[model samples]
Structures are given as C-alpha cells and as structure tokens.
Target: MRARNLAVVLATIHRSGPHTRASLAERTGLTKTTVSSLVADLLEAGAVTESGAVRAGERGRPGVAVSLSGHRVAALGLEINIDYLAACVVDLTRTVRLRRIIPADNRNSDPAAILESLRALAKETTAEAAAAGLRVIGAALAVPGLVEGGMLRSAPHLGWRDVRVSDLVDMPFEVDNEANLAALGELWFGPRESDFLYVSGEIGIGAGLVVQGGVFKGTYGLAGELGHVVVVPDGPGCRCGGRGCLEVYAGQDALLGDLGSVRELVSRLESGDQAALEACRRAGHALGVALTSAVHLLDPGTIVLGGIFAPLFPWLAAPVSGGLGTRLAQMRGAPPDLVVSATGSDAAVLGAAGLVIQQIIAEPAKLLGL
Candidate 1:
C-alpha cells in the first residue's frame, strides 16, 4: 500500500505538474501526513524537488511545489535495424543526454557481430551519460522484428531466427518491437495523443498501435505487422513469402527503387520527377489500403507517419486519403487525420530509453528502494 501510494503521489504530480503537499493529498485522496512523508522520501531519492513556496489562495499557509527532478537518473535506449544500430540515453525528464547512430548494413550479417558492435556503442554512450551526471537505471533494446518474453522470435530483414539477445549483451535489458517502441515514443514525446497508429516506414514497414495512452501489443505480440498485410492479390512477392504485401509497395526500398536514397528521392520529387511521383502515389495507395483495414478494425484517432514516410507525407497524404475515402467515410463519418512524426526516425530509440524512464516515474518507490 505504501509503495502504491508513493507511486500515486508521484504520478499525480507528473501528470498535473508540480503540487504542494496539501494539494497532492487532496488530489490523491491520501492524508496530508502521508503526502508529506512520501514527498520527503521522493526528495531524498532525488526523484522530485521542491521549489519556492507559494500560497494556495488567500487563506492558508504557503506550500512548496514539488515537481520531477531532472538529475541523477537516466536510461539507455538501443536499436538494431536492417541498416543501422543506435544507442541513446534519456534522463528522467525525457531529455536526450546522448545519442549515436552507426550506419551499417545488417542484412544477412552475423548477429553476434552486430550485437558486439551495439554493445560497444552502448558502452560509449553510457560513459558519456556518466559524465553528464546521469546514472542510467536500466536499458531497453528495440529491434525490427517480433519480440516476446525478452526474446527476438524472428527478424527476417536481419536474416535471423531464435536469436537470444541476452547471450550477446551482458546488461539486463528489456526487448521490444521497434514500431511498438516508436509508437510509445510518439505518445510520450510527440503530440501526446491518447490514441494513434504509428506506421514505421523503413526497409520493412511496421506499425505500433497506441490506444488510451498505452501500446496494444496484442496476443502473441505480433499485431503490428503492417508490412505483410496483403494489399494486392498478387502484386509482387515479398520477403515475408507473401504476395502483394504492403511492404512490397510502401517500404523504403520499394519507394526508393533506383533513386538509391531518401535524399535522392526527395531531390527527384522536388524536380517533379514522374517516376518518383508515381512511386509515392502507388505506395500511398497501398498504405491507405492496408490502413483501411486497420481503421475498420481499430479506428485509431490519428495515423502518424513515421520514419521514411514523414518526409514523403506531402505527396503521399492525398493518395492515401483517396484510398481511405469511401470506406472510412461510410464506416466512421471521416478518416482519421494523418500527421508526421515529430521525432522522425529517432522515435524508436528515444522510446526504448523512455521505457525505463517511465518505469522510474511510475514507480519511484522502487528506485527509492522503499
């Protein structure tokens, strides 16, 4: 009960901004004495700090405002994708203390080697965090595949199966799907939406479903495989052994084709290149088709275009809207608004770090060892 009360007090303050002991008690339905005691514990643990006193209206004694502290605690976020490895640290305030992205082609690469490099990168990032006076409480890793029970079940893009991440990295880390983490990232750091579907466009497309401010991982942790959703009956073969999958049309490689890079694609589109325009239109149409099913089933309030799609949203939005037009309007009266990710490609890694930070915020008593 004590631990739960402590968490309640902390969460209230975090959600409603700084609060005095009396206000925290009133808001939390705890006694003023208990609020004071918990506030003292939080102060001692460095999870929160009290600011200058302010009067609570015109009739009572002044009280100090208690808010989340920005020092001492932090977390590490790591990512292993088809073309890059990344490490980042976020403090209790969700501020990025350090970040490093190493560009590498991990397709068909040795998992052991890739993890070794990631470990090294994490080591370097943590060292830098230490210099910033932040103690990393825990770490989480994001991967472009299905993750269940802290094990990566499969990452077809990386050409691995049954790969155990713990064997490669010594740190005790939570493992999760990159798109799921990206969605959490968007929820925590982006527009702070209560419900949205974050579509991650990369070498392989994926999505993270956020509902009521929480990620819905679904049964078996395999819900957001938007890439393999068959958009065409027999459009083109996909690496997932499926025909006409959304990834075949909307993934980064599919959208880029001979353009080689996103930068080049952007350049070509700026010059009104017909091929680039056509490719985006096709990809957008496919995305809309896949998302139509998602909307009919899930009805997300917003669809956040993330990763490679953020940059291409201007050209893609109209086509996607067209594909979603008839069915969505008939079903829900209007389609959800499409928005670009504020964090861009950094969403997943930032979210990986955020997982640990949110834990600390939600249960500061654990960090206090109470």
Candidate 2:
C-alpha cells in the first residue's frame, strides 16, 4: 500500500505537472502525514525531485514544489515498424533523451536480431546516461501488430506467432501495439481534448483512436488498422494481403517511390516543390477522406496526426480540410485542425514510457519484482 501510494503520487505529478504535497494528498484522498511520508520515500528513491518553493500563502511552512525525477528513471522505447526499428531513451516524464533508427533488412530472421539490437542500444544509452548520473529502470517495445498479454500473438508482416518478447529482451520490458501506444501518447502529451484519432503515417499506416480520454481497442488488437481500409479495391496490392489498401496509397515507400529520396522530397515540399506538394496534398486528401468516413461513423472531436511525415505538414492541410468538406471535421462545431504532433518524433518513445507509468500506477505490485 505504501509503494502503491507513492506510485499514485508519482503518476499524478507526471500527468498533471508538478503539484504540491497538499494537492497530491487531496487528489489521492490520503492523509497529509501519509503523503509526506510517501513523498519522502520517493525523494529518497530518486524517483522525484524538488522543483522550487510554492508560495500558497505563508500561513505555515513554505510548500516545496516537486516534479518527476525523469533523469533518474530512463526508459527505453522501441517502435518496431515493418522495415525499420526505431529505439528511443526517455526519462520518467516521457522526455526522450536519445533516439536511433535501424533498418530491418531481413524479414524471416530479423525479429530476433532487431530485438537484440534495441536491447543493445538501450544499454548503450543507459550507460551514457549513467555516466551523466541517470539510471534506466525499464524498457517498452511497441510493435505494429496485435500484442496482448505481453506477447505478440501474430504479426503478419514479421510472420511471427506467439513470439514472447522476453525470449530476446533481457531487461525489464513491456510490449503493446504501436497504434495503441500512439493513442496513449496523444492522450498523455498531445491534446487533452477528451476525444481524438491519433494517426501514424509511417512505412505502413496505422491509427490510435481515443474516445472520451480512453483507447477504444474493440475486442481484438486490429481495431486501429486504418491503413487496411480499402481506398481503391483495384489500385495496388498491400502487404497485409489486401487490394488497394490506404497504406498502399499513402505509406512511406509509396510516397517516396514516386518522389525519389524521402529527405529530398520533404525538403523540396518545404521549399515549394510542385510534385512534393501534390503528393502530400494527395495523401492529406486521402487521409481527410478517411477521416470523413470515421467522423461519419465514430464522430470523434479531433484528429491528431503523428509520425515521420509530420515535418512536411502545413502543405497537407488544404487538401485535408477541403476533403473533409467542413462538416464533422474536428473540434465538433469548428473547422478541423489538421496539424502535426507538437510532441515531435519521439511521441512513441514517450508513450511507451507513459505505458510503464500507467501500468505501474495501476498495479503497483508489478514494480516490486521488476
């Protein structure tokens, strides 16, 4: 109970920003003495630190403000995409300290190697942070497929079944679908709009739907497979054995195939490349069209976009806005705000750390053995 109380305090501080002991006590319904004791324990554990003095009236002892000791708890997050393995190291507050990307070359045997590489990267980053006086506590891996019970039941692209992540991960690790983690990221760090669709346009498109501040994962893990939605039934073959999926139309390689280099393509688009502009417009149009369908069906309040393609975003707004037709776009009554993620490219890593925070906060006993 003591550990659990401290976890609750820590999680609350992380989500609601720095708060005073009185506020945490009131929020958690704990006694002031209990809150002080837990805070002291957390401070000693290096899980939290003092920010400054709070002047909420000098009626008593000056209240000392506290914030999460992010530097103390380094979390490594790995987003395992179809063709790439992106690893990131973040603190407890979801601030990414380091990130590295590796291309997944071989499909059949790359999963093991990729997992191993991510562990190694996490180790290296942890060592560096340790030299700088920080400690890494845990790691999280977000895969592009169904992950339930902390096991990859199936990844059609990676051709794996029941691949227990612990077989390759030697450190404390957690796993979940990339889209779900993205949704969690949006909920935690992006907008607190209560409802939003977090779309990830990467090598293959995926979505994370948040309704009323919680993820709607349906019965299966494939609930957010927006990429597999048929844009054109007879357009192009998709890796998911689908014909003319949205991913086939708007995925990374598809965007890069017609434009050559992805970096150059992004640069030219930013610098007013007609073709680049057109492609993004097309993608945005398609996404907006898809959002239109989603709006008609689910009626979400906001549609938040996050991923590598976030940089070349402003140009895609017109097509997306026009495609939505101004009705049920986003924000309910106002025009939809089709903007890139403010959390930058490390949202996934941050979200992964958020997952750990969430799990630990909800079930404090799990952190005991971990």
Candidate 3:
C-alpha cells in the first residue's frame, strides 16, 4: 500500500509539475502525513526536490512545492542503422546531456563486429556521462529491424538473422525496432501528438504506429513494416525479397543514388536540377501511395516524416500531400496532416534513451533500491 502511494505521489508531481504535500494529498486522496512521508522518501532517493512555497488553498499557509528532479540519474539510448551508429544520454529532466554519431556502412557486415563496435560506443558514452556527474540507470537499443524478446529476428539490410543482443551487451538493455523508438521519441520530445504514423526514411525505410501516445505493435510485434509495402506491383526487387516496395522508391538510398550525401541532393534540388527534383517527386509519390493504405487502415490523426525525410520535407511534403489529397478526396474528411519530425534524424536514439527515463518515472522506488 505504501509503495503504491509513493508512486501516486511521485507520478502526480511528475505529471502536474510541482506540488505541495498538502496538494499532493488532495490530488492523491492521501493524508497530509502520508504525503509528507512519501515526499521525504522521494527526496531522499534524489527522485524529487522541494522548491519555493505555494499556497495549498485560499485559506491555508504556503507549503513547499515538490518537483521531479534527479539530475544525476540518466538513461542511455543507442541506435544501429545501415550507415551509422548513435548513442545519447538523457537525464531525468529529459535533457540530452551527451550524444555521438559515427558514420559506418554496416550493410552485409558481420553481426558480431557490429555489436562489438556498438559496445565500444556505449562504453565511451557511459564514461562521458559519468564524467558529467550523471549515473546511467539503464539502456535501450534501437535497431532497424524486427526486434523481439531482446533478439533481433531479422535485419535483411544487414544480412543478419536470429541475433540475440543480450549475448553481446553486458548491461540492463531493452531492444526494440528503430522506427518504433523514433515514434516514441517524437511522442515524448517532438510534436507530442496522441496518435500518428511515423515514417522513417533511411537507407532501409520503416514505420511506427503511435496510438494514444504508445507504440501499437501488432500481434507478432511485426507491424509497421511500411518499407515493404508494395507501392509498385512490378517495379523493382527489394532486399527483403519483395517487389516494388516503397523502399525501392522512397528510401534514402533511392533518393540519393550516386549523390554521396543528402546535402548533395539538397544542393542539386536547390539548383533546380531536374533529376533531383524528379527523384524527390517519385519518392514522395511512392511514400504517399504507401501511407494511403496505412491511413485507411489505422486512421491516425497525423503522419510524421522522420529520419532522412525530415530534411527533405520541404520538397517532399507537397507531392505526398498531393498524392493523398488526390486519393482520399472522396472520403468524409481531409487526409491526415503531414509534418516533419522535430528531432529529425535523432528521433530513434533519443527515443531509445527515453525508454529508460520512462521506466524510472514509472517506478521511482527502483532508484531508491526498494
């Protein structure tokens, strides 16, 4: 009973900002004494801190306001993509204290080598976090593939299958799909919409369905494989053994081609290069075609373009909106609003760290070792 009440008090403060013990008691239906005791526990655990006084009510004396703190408690987020590896540390206040991204072509590489590199990156990040006086509570890894039970089921782009991540990393880590983590990142740190479909356009495209501010993994935790959605019935072959998939047209590789980088594509598009413009148009149209099925099936209130798509949104949004408008015109309402991700390419890694932050918030006592 005390444990549940402690969570109640801490959660109330976390959700509603600072609160006095009297106010917390009123909000949580607990006695003032109980609220004070719980707040003491939270303060002792470094999970919260008291600030200037606030009036409990119109007739009562001012009481000290308790707010969520724990500046020293942090979470680590890691990501492994086809072309890069990323790591970040987020403190309890949701501030990103440290970040690093290393460019690497990981396609068709040995999973052991990749994991070893990631382990080294993680160690470096944690060391930096410690130097900054932050204690990392836990970690979460985001990979561009199907992840389940801490095992990577398949990553066709990386030529990996059945890789147990736990065997490689020696830490408290949670594994999840990168797109899904990106959606969660957007939810906690971006537009913060309650419901949306997040499309991550990278070398290998993926999508995450955010329903009610939570990821909606399908029955097999394999939902939102938007990259493999057939946009062209007989277009081109995909690494996933699919034909005419959205990735073939809308993925970063498809858009960049031999350009070497997105900046090159952007420069060309700015110069009114007909080829670059045509490529973006094709990718946008393909994305629209893929999202159409997604919208009709899920009916999300918004759609977010993330990863490489974020930088290209200014050029891509119009074509995607046009395609959706043309297709869903007969419906009762307009198509979902499309927006660029706030964190852009950093969404997945940020979300990976956020998972640990959320766990800490959900159970503040864990930090107290209770």
Candidate 4:
C-alpha cells in the first residue's frame, strides 16, 4: 500500500509537473503526513528532487516544490532500419541526452555484422551518457519487423527471420516493431493523445494503433499491418507477396524510384513539377484509401503520419485527407483528425527509451533496491 501511494504521488508529480507537498496531498487525496513521507522517500531514491520553494501568495512560509530528477536514471534506445542504425539516450524527463545515427544498407549486409555495428553504437551511447552523469537502466531495440518475446519473427526488408535479440546483441534489451515504438514515443513525448493511428513510412510502410494511451498489439503482436493493406486491385507487387499493397505505392523506395531523392522530390513539388505533384497526389490518394479502412475499423480520434512520411506530409496531407473525407463522409459526422508526427524520424528510438522509463516509473522501489 505504501509503494502504491508512493507511485501515485510520483505519477501525479510526473504528469502535473512540480508540486508543493500540500498541493500533492490535495491532488492525491492523501494526508499531508503521508504525502510528505512519500515525497521524502522519493527524494532519497533520487527519483525526484526539491526544485526550490513555491510562494504562498503572501500568506505563510514558502513550501518546497518537488520535481522529477531526470538525470538520475536514463535508458538507451537503439534502432535498426533498412538503411541506418541509430541510438539515443533519454532521461526520465524524456530529455534526449545523446543520439547517433549511422547510415548503412542493412538489406545486403549480414545480420551478424549489423548486430556488431549496433552493439558498438550502443556502447558508444552508454559511454556518452555516463560522461553526462547519467546511468542507463535498460535498453530497447526498435526493429522494422514483427517482434515476439524479444525475438524478431521476420523482417522482410532485412531478410531476417526467427532471430533472437539476445543472439544479435550481447546486452539485455527488449525488442519491438519500429512503428509500434514510434507510436509509443509519440504518445509518451508528444501531445499525449489518448487514441491515434501512427503510420510510419520508410523503405516499407507500417502502422501502430494507440488506444487509450496504450499500444494495441493485438493477439499476435501484429495488429497494425497497414503496409499490406491493399490500395488497388492488382496494382503492384509488394515484397510481402501481396499485390496492390500500400507500401508499393507510398513507401520511400517507391517514391524515390519515381522522383529520384527526397530532396529532389521536395524541390520538384515546390517548383510545381507536374510529375512530382502527380506522384504525390497519387501516393496521397492511395494512402487515403488505405487509411479509410483503418479509420473505419479502429475509429481512432487522430491519424499521425510519422517517419519518412513526416517530411513529405505537406504534400501528402491534402490528398490523403481528401481520400479519407470522401470515403468516410457517409459513416461519421466528422473525419478523424490527421496530423504529422512530432517525433519524426526519432520516434522509434525515443519510444525505445520510453519503454524503460515506463518500467521504472511503475516500480520506483527498484531504484532503492527495495
């Protein structure tokens, strides 16, 4: 019961920011003595700290304001994308202390070699965090594939299958889908929306459904397979053995192949290149078609475009919104809000860090060796 109270006090402070003991007591519905005791315990645990005094409107003595001590505990977030390996360290306050991304073509490289490189990156990130007076409590690996029980079941983009995360990296870590991690990152660090569909565009497309501020991973941890959703009948072949999949139309590779590089694509779009405009419009239309199904099924309050999609959102939003608005106009009075991801390319890595942050928050006693 004490631990639960401590958690409540800590959570209240975390969500509502720095608070006086009296305010915390009022907010948590706990006695002033209980709140003071819990706050003292939390301060001793280094989970929180006194952030000076809060003025009492010219009435009495000032009360000390307590805030979370983010630097006391940090977590490492590592990501393996088809074209790059990245790492980031984040503290309890969701502040990124250090981050590095090395571009590598993982599609053709051996998985073992890739893991070695990622391990090196992890070591470097940990060293940097240590230098900054932060301790890494845990690490999580974000992969562009299906993850189950810390094992990667399949990554068609990387041609890897049935690989345990332990075998790939010597360090203890959790594994998760990149899109799912991105969704979690957005939820924890962005606007804190309770429900949304996060669509991540990269070499391939994927989506993560966030319901009530939690990721809905489904029965087999494969709920949001937005990439494989068919946008056109017999349109194009996808790497996933499907025709007319959304990825085939709106993925980075497809867009790059059609319009050269992203820089060039954006340039052309800005210059009113007819071909670029047409391509974006088509991609947007296809994305809209796919999201229409998602909207109908999940009925999320918001749809966030993330990853590579974030940069190109300016071009894609109108068409995608048009598609969704057209398709869902009859069913719902208002279409779900469409927004670009605030985390952008960093969403997965930040989410990876958040996984550990969340664990620590749920079990603050761990920090005290209790």
| TM-score for predicted model 2 compared with the true structure | 0.85
TM-score of each: 0.95, 0.85, 0.96, 0.92
- How does each model score on lDDT? 0.87, 0.72, 0.88, 0.87
Instruction: Find the candidate with the highest TM-score and give its number.
Output: 3
Per-residue CA lDDT of model 3 for 106-220, tens digit only, reads 9999999999999999999999988888878889999988887999999888888999886545656899999999999998888665788898898878889887658989999
Query: For every candidate structure, what is the RMSD over all alpha carbons to the true structure, in angstroms?
Result: 1.7, 3.3, 1.4, 2.3
Ranking by TM-score: 3, 1, 4, 2
Task: Give lDDT tens digits, candidate 1, residues 193-276.
Answer: 578899999988889999877888888898899998999997888887879999999999889997767988999999999999
> In angstroms, how far off is 169's CA in candidate 1?
5.4
lDDT of 4 by residue, 1-370 (tens): 8878888888888888699998898899999999999988888767888978896346777889988897677888999998789999998888888989999889855787888899889988898888888878778999999999888899988999988776544444788999999999999989855788999998889899988768999999988889899999878888778799998888888777755467788888889988878788888999999999998888988999998888889999999999999999899967899999999999999999999788777777764443
The weakest ten consecutive residues by lDDT in model 2 span 361-370
Q: How far in Å is the alpha carbon of 306 misplaced in model 1? A: 0.7
Candidate 1 CA-lDDT value: 0.87
Candidate 1 has a TM-score of 0.95
Distance from true location, Cα of 62 in model 2, Å: 1.9
Q: Is candidate 2 or candidate 4 better by TM-score?
A: 4
- Candidate 2's clash total is 0
Model 4 lDDT, residue 255, Cα = 75
